[model samples]
Target: MEQRLLAAQALGENELLDLASQRAKAVENWLLEKGHVSKERLFVLAPKVEAATEPGKDGMKARFALK
Candidate 1:
């Protein structure tokens, strides 16, 4: 996953997300197949795309919060 992320760093947003989603799905499938986690406990999440805020252009700002 680290390697993938590093390789994908130069990719555009949509492509990077698609690659990450694919990797996540693969991991989920492997966990399910190995009985490491149950289907009821683990879920596959659908990807969501949010509009990017362009500061100074649209009077919108980008913010990220870490919990």
Candidate 2:
């Protein structure tokens, strides 16, 4: 019947999608194991640099504080 054929097609599609997802996850895990993919922090805030001006006609000086 047409209904049975449609059901079989949907099941096949779902199986293919699941297999593709699993393959993708395997590749990702392999990359991580090989260190080709980095999971480190992508966004890091750098220490703020402040500019101070001496009480003279000289130019401003840059200063940084280390914790």
Model 1, 1-67: lDDT tens digits are 9667756654555664676577667777787898578777876565543444665432222222211
Which candidate has the highest TM-score of all? Answer: 1
lDDT of 1: 0.56
Steric collisions counted per model: 0, 0
Off by over 4 Å in 1: 1-9, 45-67
Candidate 1's error at 9, in angstroms? 9.2
Candidate 2 collision pairs: none
Q: What TM-score would every model get versus the actual structure?
A: 0.48, 0.39
Regions of candidate 2 where Cα sits further than 4 Å from its true position? 1-11, 40-67
lDDT of 2 by residue, 1-58 (tens): 9667755654343454455555555555666688466645122222232233455432
